[model samples]
Target: MAVRPPVSKSNVFLLMVTGEIESAEFPEYDGLYCNFSFFYGQDWTVLSNSSEGITQTSMRGSSPASNFVWNFPIDVTFKSTNPFGWPQIVVSVYGVNSLGRDEVRGYGSIHLPVTPGRHSLDIDMFVPEPASKLQKLVSWLIGPRPELVDPKFVARGEGREITRVSSQGFVRANVNIVMKDFSKQGYRNGTERFSNNSS
Candidate 1:
């Protein structure tokens, strides 16, 4: 298991996903059409105080953003709309840890301008989840598995990555990726108002 920063009451951390389609409650599992599973630690508060009637707005520019400005529970999936039509295909997380330290981490964003239709989103168990040495050895012996990636992506270091695509008709972008150090517990974020506008 990846070491987690110690937990305490001094912090109120959160992870915000800036994407297209304005905003959306993180789907636990979309089944098949678009299965986006929560891959990392489930404790990162998505909306510190998210409640019904809380307004989430998006203004798309270079990259689409579905910014969450509220807080909600750990298991609840909050849903909102992309003011510009299409959803922010890319996703990342920002939050603070139990220590009250501010931090930002990036995960690979998936974009499929082609390959129409929904795929599957699984809470990626390959990374952060703690496993015994035997389990790791067995998986290694089982050979490798194909991973997903966004073709238009550019790595920005510090776990940050970005991708862009022009509309080519009838394709819906679905991303599912776990960033390095995502849920390492050592990660933290400074809580402040963020804009969905991308650079």
Candidate 2:
């Protein structure tokens, strides 16, 4: 048997970039990416490779182990671009099974507006664990101090903390939502704050 990661799991490959362009007028290329490990039967590490694009990146079952799902993710950053036309960004991923089979894929493409603004996407990095778990563990040992965004408020329950972030963001330390405990607390008097839905 061969060792492999499972599907139905998501690992954040890249930070949540505010914005990225599908294509640019000057074409500022970021780079290629990979999620699977390159080394096997030894201590694994941050495996990576440099390539022009996926058109040249290849995978084969003949290797000691094979990729079950060739699908990886790519993200783009928009430095500058023309004003007239929007360009399309294309991406694709495939996989092979033990029986030498390839998975059907969709020709992924994105048409980004030329106008400058913010954008975001869920990048995929095939680490063996969820991105959050990796962060908590590595950050502690590797001396990574999180940005520490101003938490509006903190409420803890059963080893879980609900933080109301400054940007009206609410993060549940636990991923479950349906069973989340909700409540209404009265302001002890003039401790009231007002907010509007208008951005």
Candidate 3:
């Protein structure tokens, strides 16, 4: 009788983020760029080579919508103890200022699918609004807000262009990913950093 080798417990998955923003709320009209990152529980992996997230889809003209695809796909290997519990994809949009400072125009997050297959997702962008004195006072008295990014900025609709003045409307984008799941791979969790987009 021949003996069979045991399958390893870890799983590998490839992640791809498609870039698009139907509309973005900005105080001024200027060129725009986007950055993206993937977070698993507490641990995080950037989709870019620089400390900042991946730089992509630069809009030269004054426009709210951007449709560009990030050619690079990130490969991540982790323990698939609970495959259902996948991470979240966070996106940050920035506007390039004349002074060389980049201001955050919007932020958003989308849940990643755990099942191994190609999936398409629509992620809505959330733009921050300046708070009133009373709102800030009340929040301070109660306690610090939970999220680093304000929750009130979350857009209500998906793939719609926002044109409200007070609301400083938001936008949505599409992301397509082909997640290839592999078992018994040589790579292990914590063995090495996932990848550097620069390389």
Candidate 4:
């Protein structure tokens, strides 16, 4: 009889994400660009190099109510021993002003879908507002908009309550998620077991 090698158990699971930052609606803005990044827990390790990128500047369409189209691609893979900290994508948009400087227009974030399949997310974007009228006037004169020092702060709930922000616009994203060994790791949810077939 041939002896069988001992079976090895692996706890790691893979999360694959492929998507694009499709478009945005900034009614008053033109000549827009975007910056994107991921925020994940300590347990997660990125397996792909498409972690962060900047999109080319896009001008608003000629017609009224036309959105800025970037179609920026997103492809990333992550491996983790546990799902304690799922990943979230953070997006910051900027517009070229009369001074030709990039001024932050909006900030938004969305948690990656827990299930493995295609997902479309419309992230509501907001911009920090000046706390006082004097501050607002100064910013308007100086061409310095109220912007976050660290845009990733959008991903976290802490300390956000203290900041005053105004709704500016929204960004659309399309993402396809694939999971490996998720069920084998004893993590199963009603939605997690669904088929990958897009409806």
Q: What is the TM-score (0 to 1) of candidate 2? A: 0.23
Tens digit of per-residue lDDT, candidate 1, span 29-113: 1111111223222343233232112122212233233222222211222222211111223333323333443222222233222
Question: Model 4 clash pairs?
Answer: none
- Lowest summed lDDT window (length 10), candidate 4: 190-199
List residue ranges in candidate 2 displaced over 4 A: 1-52, 55-85, 121-199
lDDT of 1 at 199: 8
Question: What's model 1's lDDT at 136?
Answer: 53
Candidate 4 wrongly placed segments (more than 4 Å): 1-5, 191-199
Q: How does each model score on TM-score?
A: 0.20, 0.23, 0.47, 0.92
RMSD, model 1, all Cα superposed? 20.2
**Backbone clash tally for model 2?**
3
5-103: candidate 3 lDDT, tens digit per residue: 998644444444443333344444456666665545423343433322455544434444534334333343333333333566566666654555565
Displacement of residue 198 (Cα, Å) in model 1 is 31
lDDT of candidates 1 onward, in order: 0.26, 0.24, 0.45, 0.90
Model number with the top lDDT: 4
The total number of steric clashes, by the backbone 3 Å criterion, in model 1 comes to: 29
Show pairs that collide, candidate 2: 19-119, 70-94, 70-95
Q: Model 2: per-residue lDDT, tens digit, 56-92?
A: 2343334433332223333332211111222233333
Q: 133, model 1: CA deviation in Å?
A: 25
